[model samples]
Every structure is written in structure tokens, then in C-alpha cells.
Target: MNLEDSTALQFDTPYMVIDFNQSLKNMKKVQSFADQHGKTLRPHSKTHKIPLFSKRQISLGAVGVCVQKVSEAEVMFDGGVEDILISNEVVTGIKTDRIADLASRGCRIKVAVDSEVGMSSLNESAREVGKEIDVIIDVDLGMDRCGILPDDFPGFLKKSSGYSNLTVYGIMAYDGNVADESRSERSRKVASEVETLTKLCKDYERINGEPQTVSVGATSTYDLWAEYDIITELQPGTYVYYDRRTTEYGASTMDEIAMGVVGTVMSKTHSNHAVIDAGYKSTSIDNGRYPILIMPSGDTAPVTSMSEEHTVCSDANQLKIGDRVLLLPSHACTTTDQWDKAAIFGLNEKPGTIEIKGRGMRE
Candidate 1:
């Protein structure tokens, strides 16, 4: 049945829905932005966790897909995505073995490493499988997350030279800390980070040779990074289906957000508040921002509280029992992980189910 029709209301509640048309537009816009700036678009797959969406992104000119875990990369590889990058470090022996296995199976898999230990583990695992794995040095550009310091890149590069089973592909940095700042402030911060990265790349080339890739940026700093001459690739994941935080940070508007939770009003115990079937289990609260309730009257209400099975909304008195509400989640990444499947719909099309193939791939 056509999801745009009223019959869509009869399927089920508390399910994630994606407006395919909006999502396609978002993908195309980012692709065009990257193409115009001479940057490779390697969108992170952790946002949607759907291989079908990854294929869509690739078809729209994305160079490849970026994953956070070896298992997530395996999922994408199984789904026919050939080139995959584990954009985060994988230090565990089991995870490294999986990466080596993928390489032995003819998958072009590259991973990020921040330390000698991680490089050694990856090299040993690759050696055991009689294969070589490509790796990128993850530089900590003020995010203080999982990356080697800019000053420490030389030492790491020297250590990496000893690993014959590992090839140093390039460098990667994630500027996640500047996502919520104003565009001007974010550009300033990104410029500084880009300078550090550029110098590091030059220094590495001087010491050894030119690296293959220099990756950077998130959804917030994508446009800023596009203007730089140093960055070779862009890795912005959330632009596909922006969330409440994206809108709040001015990265995307609410109308551009393509994903939402369709829930049923289960109770109206108070005069000014009501309960819905979706709660923390359905939407993410990691950013301390709750989902916004899209009321039936084309208005909005604030989500006051949420438990495992209930979402309490303030000023939901206009909603009655069995009423439907569309909730825009706070963070699209975590919210996508909460569901195993999504109902994808578009104008003049039937709603179809797509498996969240990369879900629960925390390893």
C-alpha cells in the first residue's frame, strides 16, 4: 500500500520511518557539495546502518563507506560494498583477525590506528592470514578521542614501518567537538585543525613519502573542510538523516530531517501531558535532548520524559488515546541503532522495509 495514504497508519506504531525522497535529496546535495569541492565523499555508515542506503550513497558518487568497527565493515562487505574503512581503531586480537580475514577474502579493507600496539596487532593478524592490510594514522586533532597526537605521528610512522603486513595508507581526523558551535566559530576551529593536519601530512611526506589519503570532517564541518586544499576526503554521516541535534546546531533544518518515530498515544493521565509508546528504547537520549513530538495539528510539543516503553510529552492534551505522533529523535546515529528495521516511504510510493544490517555491531 502507498505509505502516503492513510492506510499507512494501520501498519504499526513505535517504528522508525524514513522519507526516501528527502533522504535522496540529502544524499545528492552532499554528493554535489563534495564533487564541486574536489573532495571524496566517504559517508559514515553508522548513521543509517542499512546497506541499501550505503549502496544508494555509492550510486550517488560517494567514493566508499566508512564504518566504526570491523564487524560493521564486514556487514557492509557482505552487502556488496567493496571499499570499506574502519574509521576507528581496532586493537583487539579478535577484531584484528576479522579484519585480516576480510582482506584475505578479497575485500579492500583499511583501518585507522593511533598507536604502535594497534599497528602491531593488526600486522600480526594479517600475517597469520597471509595477507596485508592497509591502515591510516588517526590523528587526534583536539577531539581527544581515538587518535595519535600530531607530534607523535613521526614515532608512530617509524613504528609502523617495521610491520611488513600493514601498509600505511594515509591519515584521518575527526572534528566532532566543534559540531555544536556557530558556523564562524566552527570554521575557525576547523581551520586550525586543518592546519595541524596539513603540516603533519607534509612532515610525514618529508620523512617517508606522500600518504594516499588525508581524511577529515563531520556533518557540521563538512562545508568548511571542503574549502581546504589539504583534505582529500570528507566523512560526514548524519547529513543523510539529520536529527534534532543537527537542527539545533544549524547543520540542517527540521524539514530536511528524513527520519522519525511513528508512535501511538497510549495514555493521557494528566490534563496537560500524555504518553506515547516510544521511549528511550525507541529514540536516543545520549545528547540529553529529547525527541520533538510532531502533533497532528501541524504543531509540536516537547518530550518531557521517557522510560523504556513510554514517552511523556508536555502539552500533549490535544492528543487522545490511539492517536499517532511523529517524533524526531535527538541523535540519528544512536536512534538508528535502536531499531532492527525501518519503514521507508516516499511520495507516490509504497512503504518498504529495510533491515538495519549494521545494527548491534558494537564490536
Candidate 2:
């Protein structure tokens, strides 16, 4: 894909645009931090599922990649990521079987679980394959998303202990509350969360009788957790494409933002609002009520309103017909899911595009 002379060639009304230079910088920063802290850098691939980005991450000394779904793990494995960890629980029979198959095929795979059902699924699949599947218990520090409480963890582990084909790897606790914008509050939350996981690690070591590998923290709180020496691996997905929210967390600035949506001005409305072709379908608005827009000069334009097919930005008079604009989405993961491919930009040329291999993983 030679994009050197592609020259303003519009494909669709809206598409994902990536800055290769900024992305490389972001990757280097995260990798360097992980190395400095002696933590394994296992970036989450769900942010930018492009194969080229994964290769670059591995080249930057990333031990492996982290994903949430089985299909995502499969895609990354096929893309030359030899080691993978599904940071979330995999309960479905088919998904676990697929994971087992991947493990049999020589991909170093590890999955998380917070329930007996999830463990049984993986154990059964591993039994069928006659192999041992690495496992981690996901703990709920505060985010009521998918992990189990710290107290219920023992039972969850005990139930799966009898399986000879299952190796209890460690615990994965993601404290999303640490991503709070308030610096003092975020620091306190990260400290407490790491402390809690540290206690759990000691307790598990006492009861289960072995050293545990704890994989916790996001890109926002990784710096704090890295200081504690409790977390063994860092799974910060959004660092690859820093979003507006992550920027608020002080992980990266607007210039460090590597992902953007290239959109065209479609309509001129009120004096305060200008509409763009990219909407909910083109750029995901799932993070909150609004999205972040970027201009030609690299300034962000606030999203005043959004619909399925249109997004209204502030300062309508500033935009003209057919004027191209860029947008730094609110949530990089959700926004990247909106595109099938990303235009990878170079230092002095049009952007080269790469396929988002691990998308829409639901069966």
C-alpha cells in the first residue's frame, strides 16, 4: 500500500487516520516505562488491531499482546504475536476450545476467570486437547465490569484446582477508577488498588502455596503501580492511541495522540455548530455524551451534538464546505472498533492503511 501519492483520495465520508510517528513514540514510551519498572509490556491489541502496529510493539520489546476475546487473540497470534493473554474471562465452550486449539498450535496463551463456570469451560477444552492451559483470576477492585470480588476468589480458584491441565497463572485486577482526572484522587485510588492486590497476592501465596504473577493496572495508573513492584505485567491498550479521556488522565497530550478520524464538513448549521459526516457510526460516541474533534492545525474542536449520521462541532463559521477535519475520539478502544482499517501515516507522505484484524469478535 503505497500512499505516498495517494493525494487526497477520499474513500468514504469518514475513516480512521493514524500518525505513524506519534504512534511509535507512544509505543516507545510505554515500552520504556515497562522496562524501567521491570514489568512485562503486554499491550492490549483492542485499541489498534492493525497487524503492523502489533509487529512494531513486539519490535519495541513487548513480551506479548493482551486481548479480550478469543478471535482477537487468534488474529494477533496469526499476525506474529507469539504470546497472548485474554485479560477478560472466556466462558463460552467454543471460545475456550478455540483457545485450546491455539495453545496446541504453540501460541503461549493465558486466559482470565472469575467463576467456576469459566474455569470448567477452559478445563474441559484443555482436557479435550490433552494440554495445560494457563489461567488467571480476574479480580474486581472497583469496576463492576467482569471480575469477581476478592473474598470469592478462593472458591473460584479451589474449584479449578483439580484440573491437571490448568495452571493458575496469576490475578488480573484493573482499577479503572484510577483513570480519574483528579490527580490526587487518581493517585490515592491507584495506591489503594495496588495495595489490595498485593494483599490478595500474599493471601493466595499463603493458601495456594506458590508465587503468583499479578497482571494489573491500565496505562493511566501504570506509572503508579510500577513503583510498587506488585504488578508483573502492564496491559495498557489505549497508550497505542491515546484518547481524550486518557489525555485527561495525564497519560499523553494531544500531540501524543496517534489516532484520529478524518472527516469532511458536510453542512453548515448554526453559528456555534458545524456538522461533519462522521457520526456515531463513523466514530463511536460510547465513552460519554460527546466526542473530540481535531482541526487541521492539531487543535481539538468540541463536539456539541451527535447523531447516527452527523456530528455537530462548535464554531460553525470556522468550517467550510468540503473542509477535511480530524477527530481524537473520547475512547480509543470503542472508536477503533468503528473502523475496519486505519490509514498509517508516514513522516512525509499520505497514510498507508492496515486492516483491523480482530474486530466484532462475538459469535
Candidate 3:
């Protein structure tokens, strides 16, 4: 939904705007893709951080939602999300207790464990609460940031039997590192990884029982991941509000992007030089690319530099003071975190704002 009809600039500058219709379209398209491939869509909530969107995703045939932090789980559970998978490890005692507490209150909490200490902490907490917490062994799968290596997974699984208050939910093998600029190369890497993951799951199930869950996929490899039956669920989050990187990877087109930071030109030193009120303080460049600037006329504006609260563009395309423009972030996940609420555009009537329910839930 674009504000094309001169009725769009009623709001203040430097607002995080969401195209409601486009966001819904993006969600539906991905959900349909997952359904066609017979995979459960458990979108990662870290992208939007709003429980309303999470519930909306669930309503559109998603099984539940995935979050990376215990605090994010708490926020979603409080927002009436019953099933949540904390797709990251919780090694701290307090955070583990929070997870156990949520479980004791009847929220289905599943967490990923990659080390003995994390599992032990979760086990102790769940034991105190007397609740059975589902645990998914995180397999490294070349990420190297977390998870146990594939060769040591069996030993890790063997060791987990001692934890009485925990159940092996399955495995979370995210091929996040399988990203390549070439679509064919990316597809090949994902297929190879999926094949290996499938063999591990099948071999383990042949001896033991079937793993309760097999969660994987990121937006970069979501389409390729859906082609395989090795996994039971998909965990792509950025599909909700694809950013510039999504376009660069060919996972999304420019029009499919549903998020942007709207900023007004506050100062124009020259016709080609203008300062936008939005900068790193409003959006982010963590993905190592400047936010793509678009004028009201839909022409691209080349950004020169971004400081705390101002973005200087060398080629403003004849934009002047008081003119409003949109800047699309390269990394939607990090950019979304900068705002507390989003000014919703493309609605039927006046714009409305929704709180970022899980914003700043880093703990």
C-alpha cells in the first residue's frame, strides 16, 4: 500500500511504515508455498516483534511462531500464543526458569539446546516446576555460531536421556550459512544439507522413536528448503517484511517488500544535496549496505552518508525541503527493532499504529 494520493504525509517524519496489504500478501504467499510442500510454517517473530502479526501468521495456517529469546517467548505467550519454539539456546539459569514458568502455566515451550550446560540449566528449571519441556538438539550444519557438530549428535542425544523433565522435540538444523548469490548454487547447497539432515533423522529414528519435530529454513533458502520432506516445519521470518537483502538474494522482489522508514527532507543545501531526518537512528545498515532511498516519484536517491539522525544524499533527484521519501533497509530484522510502533499504511482508512510487542526483548 503506497501513499500515492497526496493524503499520505499527515504523520510526522522518520516513522517506520508498514504496507498492511503487501505484508499480508507476503505472508499468504509464503504460507501457501509451505502448505503446498506439506511443511508447517513457524515464522520467526523476531522480524516484526509484534504479537498481532504473529497471531495473524498463525491464523493463516502457520502452526505457531519461532523466537530467539526467552523474553520474546514470554511476550508472545502473553499475547495468547500457546505454542512457541525458542529457536536459540538458553544457558542462563534465570532465563531457563522463565521458560519453565511459562510451561507450568500451560504454554507449549520448546527450546533449542546445543551444549550440556544449556540442557542442564533447562532441565533443572523444568524439574523445579515439574513440567516437561521439549528440547530440540541444535545441529551446527556449518553455522559454527551454535549447535553441536553432526558427528557428536548421537553422543549428545545419548546424554540427554538423563534429563527427566525434558523431551527431545527433534532437531533444528538451520542452513543459514548455505546462502549464495547464485540461485542455483544456493539451491545445490541447501539440497545437499537437507539430504544429510534427512539421513541423520531417519537413522536416529530407525533405532529410537521418531523425532517429534524437524525445524529448519531461513528466508534466503525458504523456497529451496520447502522442496525437501526431511524437515517437518519451516522457520523463515523475514518473509513478513522483506528488506533490501531479500531482494538481493532474489528471495523477494522490490515490490514484495512491505517495510520502509519514511523520512522528510529537513534541509536541502543544494538541489542534489538534501538531508533526510532518518539515519542509523531510524533504520540500520547492519547488513553492510545503505538503505535504498526512494522519492515520492519512485526514483532512486543515492545516499551519501548516514549519521545518528540525518541521512545526506548526494543525488536527491530534485527533492526539496518538506518533501517525504521512503528508505528501505537492507536488513529488516535489525531495522524493525529501531521503532517502538509502526505507522500502518495501505489501510482502508486513516493510518493506525501497532505496538512492537516484543521490541527490545533481547534477554
Per-candidate TM-scores read 0.96, 0.92, 0.96
Off by over 4 Å in 3: 1-9, 346-348
In order, what lDDT does every prediction score?
0.87, 0.79, 0.87
The list of candidate 1 runs beyond 4 A from truth reads 1-7
**Per-residue C-alpha lDDT of model 1 across residues 1-363, encoded as one tens digit per residue:** 112332254458889888878889999999999999999999999999888889899999998899998889999999999899999988888989999999988889999988777888899999999998889889999998889888888888888777999888788999999988988999899888878988898878976698789998899998999999888999999999999999999999888889888888999878988999999999999999899888776678888889998999887768898888888899999999999988877733666777898999988
- Residue 40, model 3: lDDT of 92
Clashes of 3: 0
Q: In model 2, how many backbone clashes occur?
A: 1
Estimate, for each residue in 195-306, the C-alpha lDDT of model 3 and write its tens digit: 7788779756864578877889999888888887677889999989898888988899988889898999999877679999999989988877889888888888899899
Candidate 2 TM-score over all chains jointly: 0.92
Clashing pairs in 3: none
Q: What does the lDDT read for residue 90 in candidate 1?
A: 85
- Error at 93, model 1, angstroms: 1.9
* lDDT over C-alpha atoms for residue 355 of model 3: 86
- Colliding pairs, model 1: none
